[model samples]
Target: MRGPARASYRPVTQRLEVTFLPGLGEIVADEIVERLAPARPPRPVPGREDALLVDHAGRLERALSLRTAVAVFLVLTFDVPRPKSLTSGEHLPRIADAMATSVRLGAARTFRFEAAGHDSSVFQRLAAELAHATGLVHDDAEGEVVVRFRRTPRNAPQPGATRAPTDQAGWDVLVRLGGRPLSARPWRVADFPGAVNATIAAAIVRLVGTQADDRVANLMCGSGTLLIERLLAGPAATAVGVDIDPDAVRATQENLVAAGCAGRATVTRADVTAAGGSWRDAGPFDLVLADPPWGALHGSHVTNPALHADLLRVAHEVGAPGAHLVVLTHEIKVMERCIREADAHWRVRAELRVFAKGHHPRIYVLEHV
Candidate 1:
């Protein structure tokens, strides 16, 4: 056998933590490892499914460009004395000094603080201490620095009547590596009721693996998140979005304009289910993505079965040979039943459960053959 290839040299790594929606830490880790090629792959923090730590050797800007994490934080671990051993008067200055040093290093003029697993009294004390040390004016509305403090043991019981902290472990102070959360994309200028999160939308687009110059379509495209994400991903030959609701169509159109992709993407007020033979001329799309209504709310859940059936029928009509259809929804049972009963020429290629907002939505990638 040939000699093993040598590993390329990488820069010194820094410990960084990425926060994602719960249940998606592994996906985020995979993304980090694939994109950043960290010296050490990301591993979930103990007892916290929402956070993962990685020793990244690449530029922070590159990590930020990944767009998978909600917020990336630079961790500062400080060992504290015993519980109640040091009150705000004694310990507050030290904590503030550390945070202030972090801010100085970060070079931000303003900051904000949030205390977890603590009541109002503790929250106030910590916030007050940080404010004093950093001398960075606290601007909760739009602070450049997002300083978060948490119990060292991680998810230890909050000091409350029901449960109390027995011992005081040191604390981990996380300073946000960026000014704004990565989930808040600048392209999302318009909003709708069920607009998908930008990060989730990006992830779905990545999973679909659309090709440059490929014809793409988004059925039931609410607010045009998927279409915009596709356009942002690469130069598609044609991007089409259809929504039956006029408001959704208008909103998506406005968003496309805001994203400066009006020429590259088009949104029409037409129902995907009713496209029927009318869209036959739209020329079998190579990739079809949809974020149909999941009916999770009180009024919309009942009509999902019909919606799922109609989606399959429309997908069958529009999908090109070897095309892919990616769907994000929370109604697994209805979608699975519809898939089983569909007369369409498609099979589930991959599936993942992702946490979105307060709901856990499943993304299914179906390949048309």
Candidate 2:
């Protein structure tokens, strides 16, 4: 009768490792260090691609919530005297013991195996062998325990804990902390055709930076990912989003509502090129973020060039002096030409390459002069 005794949860702190998309590891690393201060300085795993291992000291789930990386894992390392011995059946029991121990550490009931591309066949065989040795069913469908195998780099760091037997093998077993990637935001209830990846959006907002009272604008704001991410990054005086398509505008509205920023953010349907309007009266935002359509993906190829030029000009006019603008696009050549030829008074501040959904887009940060 007392509201079911009020549900509660106690946080668990543990040391862990994180892996992100190759090009974006540094940003993920910075975010992690800023959010959760690790025991020792976080280090990029030697010879490992896009991995940062740290001895963290806070609740694992809390630390996971603070990061935007693709995956967080409880790491276990094994030694193989001979790399070729992996294919032999001799090490099966030891590998199974390591996996079973990792599952217990992750507190998962059922488990699955995931390996990238060609290594999948090797992992499948290893998974079967481990299942036979440990009596754990290999359930790929709804496995709560996710056992991922990785070929450890030659110089990978030693494990922080001695629970798992460590010899001198070149393999690492990582049990994923969450079922899904942290970048998949829950606020994305309504998605537009080419919505920006939420992790990339968070990175862009971090690069642009913010204050408690800065006014922000997002042009071509499809599904409002950028705006929602910016809002989450920090408080703002006002946030506005504009798009030419009514469908996009509606989608932004829905996403904003889902993100609980409906009151703090506004979305309108209007051509961004036509600058002198009521939108301009709101005038001179402290930051402007744009993710214009790349010609090859959703919109037609012809319109993007003109749209890019117009976006620069309009952003220049609507941005306050010393304001910042961040733009993401795959049409780098065209955008570069626009920056060269346009009358807009702006200078490129920084540029970063980020991979998203099979397309490599460059994010340009510009400062209003």
Local distance difference test, per candidate? 0.76, 0.76
TM-scores, in order shown?
Answer: 0.81, 0.79
Off by over 4 Å in 1: 1-12, 82-110, 117-129, 139-144, 153-169, 275-280, 296-299
lDDT of 1 by residue, 4-86 (tens): 99999868666788898875665677789888888766877655778888887777667777666898887766676532322
For residue 41, model 1's alpha carbon misses the true position, in angstroms, by: 0.6
Clashing pairs in 1: none
Top TM-score prediction, candidate number: 1
Tens digit per residue, CA lDDT, model 2, 207-228: 7777998999998898899999
RMSD per candidate (Å) reads 6.6, 7.7
TM-score, cand. 2 vs. native: 0.79
Give per-residue lDDT, candidate 2, residue 74. Answer: 73
Error of 1 at 174 (Å): 0.6
